[model samples]
Target: MHAITIPEPGGPEALVWAEVPDPVLAEGEVLVEVAASAVNRADLLQRQGYYDPPRGASPYPGLECSGRIAALGPGVAGWSVGDEVCALLSGGGYAEKVAVPAGQLLPLPEGVDAVTAAGLPEVACTVWSNVFMIAHLRPGDTLLVHGGASGIGTMAIQLAKAAGARVAVTAGSAEKLERCRELGADILINYHEQDFVQELRRATDGAGADVILDIIGAKYLDRNVKALAVNGRLAIIGLQGGIKGELNLNALLSKRGAVTATSLRARPEAEKASIVAAVREHVWPLVAAGRVRPVVDRTVPMRDAAEAHRAMEAGGHVGKILLVP
Candidate 1:
């Protein structure tokens, strides 16, 4: 199988396309002939030797893919050969063939193609787990999202709105903020010029946001706490800023706010399976009904993953970047 492998970690240029041993399916896994993969910020970190795949995971950069089942491992059921599916992979999505846990597989949402479906897993799981499962965003709650133009951001805005939450987002530019607004964001903040804490408070009439989804970790830590309403929940999913920062405990305590963090890639198979199931039951219906959709900014060939990484680094894309395999 042809794969994009980092022989030795360096930069996007380190992603070398070469023939490698085909992945073998394990118990409760399925062999997927990958149709497409999508780029995430974490892929860049993995390529640069910062993020290592968990034990027994594929040593490739991709975290999600859309493909067909070429074969199934022992105990697999409710699916068969040639089933069209998109799956959240531990890694190895950069390859033509990846062995994915059957439990993590989801049927391509109605009206979506393989390439577009490739962009679904990471964002879907990230938004569902963080916004719904962790923060418990309910109808009428005010939800704030950082990196509102990102793949996760777009998906989060849509999901939160569909669930009846009032969505607010922060991005770097007016164009990106407009895009978020189009996706149902009620309040938009240009982070480059506006203070998110102040804007969020003003947007909510000094009540602050009920739930805040953050990607810039250390840089936003203090202000995020200050921007929370009473009993608000802050879920940090990325550290685009520095990882270490001081937090004002007094602010959190005063607001009775809670802070939590997680990475989808680091979860156990069973945990991921549960999230997938929940997404299938709840989120998949929204996509099927066209109330939500994958936001793809561009599509690049699998061999041009280096270009995708470069594009993401340049920060010009408004949504997900797909890699056709």
Candidate 2:
């Protein structure tokens, strides 16, 4: 099996595709013959030596993959060999084959192909867990998604809208915001040209957002609190702007808002399985019905993952970047 390996973390150039021994499946796990994988911002952090795979996880960078099942391990059931599926993984999706916990596997949504399914698991699970499961975004609620043009942001926009919530998104450019609007975002704010807090407040007649899916972390913490509606929920999933931030507790208190930060990769297997199940029950139907769909920026060869990383760092792509094995 050939997987992307990092001999020494530095830049995209550090990712090396090398022949590695096949993964050994454990109890309740299955071996998947990888069809494709998708790039995430976490992969960039891993390649730069800032993030390491969880203990006992695959050392490769990918956190999700789509492939056919080659073999199922002991205690695994309800799925068979040759089953076309996508899975949420802690690591090792950037390989020819990967071992996945059976619970984390999901059948490809109807009308979606293997390559497209590769981009579905991470974003789908992320949005479903944070926006619907945790924050409990209700119908008629206004949900604001930061980094609206990125993989998770795109999915968040569609899912929130599908659930009868109004969607708002912040993107770096007008073109990206336009793309978000096409995906059902009701309000699009160009972060480069506008203040998201003011823009969102104005769009909602100063009621502010009922929920905020934020990725910029500390840079937007204070403003995010200020931009929340009464009893609003804020789910912070990324720290792109740095880890530490000063929060106005008084402001959050006044609004009675809630804040939560979570990471999907470091969770226990059972927790991941639960999230996958929720996604299959709630999101898969929407995707299969074509009310929601995968948004792919482009596909690159697995061996050339560095190119994908460069493109992501360049910050021009609109959605998930697929890596075909």
Candidate 3:
């Protein structure tokens, strides 16, 4: 088998595709012959040596993939060899073959091709778990997402809109904002030129956002608080803006707001299974019904993953980028 390995992480150039020993499946796991895997921001961090895989996970950068089952491990049932599936992975999706826990395997949604399904798992689980399950965003609420052109951001916009919430997004460019609009975002703020706090407030008649899906972490924490409505929920899934920041407890207390930080990759198996189950039950239907669709910016050959990483770091793509093995 061949997988992308970082002998010493440094840059996109560090993602070297080379032959490696095949993964040996453990009990309750299955071997998947990888078809495609998607690039993520976490993959960028891993490539740069900032993030490492959890203990016992594959030493590969990818976190989600679509593939066919080659074999099932002990205790695995209800799925068969040769079944087409997409899975959320702790790591190792960058390879031609990966071993996945049975609980993480998801049936490809009806009407979605296998290649495109590669882009769904991470974004779907991340957005659904954080925004809907954790924050409890409901109909008529206003949801704001930062980095609106990102894979997570694009998924968040569509899912929130489909759930009857008014969606707002902050993107860096007009083109990205226009794409967000096309995905049902009701308010689009060009973060390079405008204040999202003021823009979202004005859009909601000063009620502010009922829920905020934030990625910029520290740099946006203070402003995110200002942008929240009373009793609002802010879910932080990324710290791209740096890790340290001061919090104004008084402001949050005044609004009765809540702030939560979570990561899908570091979650326990049972918790991940629960989130995957929720996604299959909820978000998959929206996708099967054509209410939501996979947004892929482009696909690159698995051998050229370095190129894909470069594209992600360039911050030019509007959605997920797939790596076909």
Candidate 4:
């Protein structure tokens, strides 16, 4: 099988297209013939030699893909060969075929094409787990999502809004903010021109946001706590700004707030299975009902994986960037 891989980590230019060994299905796993895969910030880190796939996982960089089941492993039941599905992968999605644990596979929503379904799994699982599962965002609560036009951010805004929460988002430009607004964001802050904390406070009538989905960690940590409402919950899912920061414990205590940081990729298979199960139960219905849809910025070929990395690093996207395998 031909896969996109990094010979030596550096720039997107380092990604090479070449033949690699096809993945062998293991117990509870399924072999998927890849149709498409999506680009992620984690892929950028992996390409730069900063992030490594988990032990016994594929060395390839892709994190999510949509495909058809070509084969099923021992003990995998209820799904047949040729099932149209999209799956969350540990790695190896940037190839013609990928082996995924059965628990991580999601049936493609009715009416969604395979190429678009490829963009759903990672953002769906990531946003659903963080915003709803971990942070406990509830009806009438307010959520402040950083990077509103991002793949995860767009999904977060829609999900939070659909759940009857007021959604606020911060993007770098007016155009992106407008897009977030169209996606159901109630408050739009152009982070380049406005201070997010101040804007959030003002938008929430000085109460601050009840829940915050943050990608910037260190640089925004202190101010994030300051911008949090009483009893607020903050879920940190990325470290784009930096890792280390001075957090004011006093602010957290004053607001009676808490912060939870996590990543879906590093979780044990059982935990991911739980997340997938929850998503299938709760969020998948929204997709089926047409209340949620995959938002793709563009689709590129798998061989141009380097270009996808560069686009993500340069922030030249409003939604998911996909690669057709």
Q: How would you encode candidate 3's per-residue C-alpha lDDT over 226-293 as one tens digit per residue?
A: 99999999999999998988999999998899999999999999999999999999999999999999
- Candidates in order, TM-scores: namely 0.99, 0.99, 0.99, 0.99
Measured by TM-score, how close is model 1 to the native structure? 0.99
Candidate 1 weakest ten by summed lDDT: 196-205
Model 3 vs. true fold: TM: 0.99
| lDDT per residue (tens digit) for residues 1-325 in model 4 | 9999889999989899999988998999999999999999898899899999999999998999999999999999989999999999888888999999999999998879999999989999999999899899999999999999999999999889889999999999888988898889999998889999999988888999999999999999998999999999999999999999998998899999999999899999999999988888888898888888888988899999888888888896999999997
RMSD of candidate 1 to the truth, in angstroms, is 0.7
Give the per-residue lDDT of model 1 (tens digit) for 57-151.
99987999998999989999999999999999889999999999999999999999988999999999999999999999999999999999999
Q: Runs in model 3 with CA error above 4 Å? A: none
For candidate 2, lDDT tens digit of each residue in 22-91? 9999999999999999999999999999999999999999999999999999999899999999999999
Query: Which regions in candidate 4 have their CA more than 4 angstroms from the true location?
Result: none
Clashes of each: 0, 0, 0, 0
**TM-score for candidate 2:** 0.99
Root-mean-square deviation of candidate 4: 0.7
Candidate 1, superposed: residue stretches over 4 Å from native: none
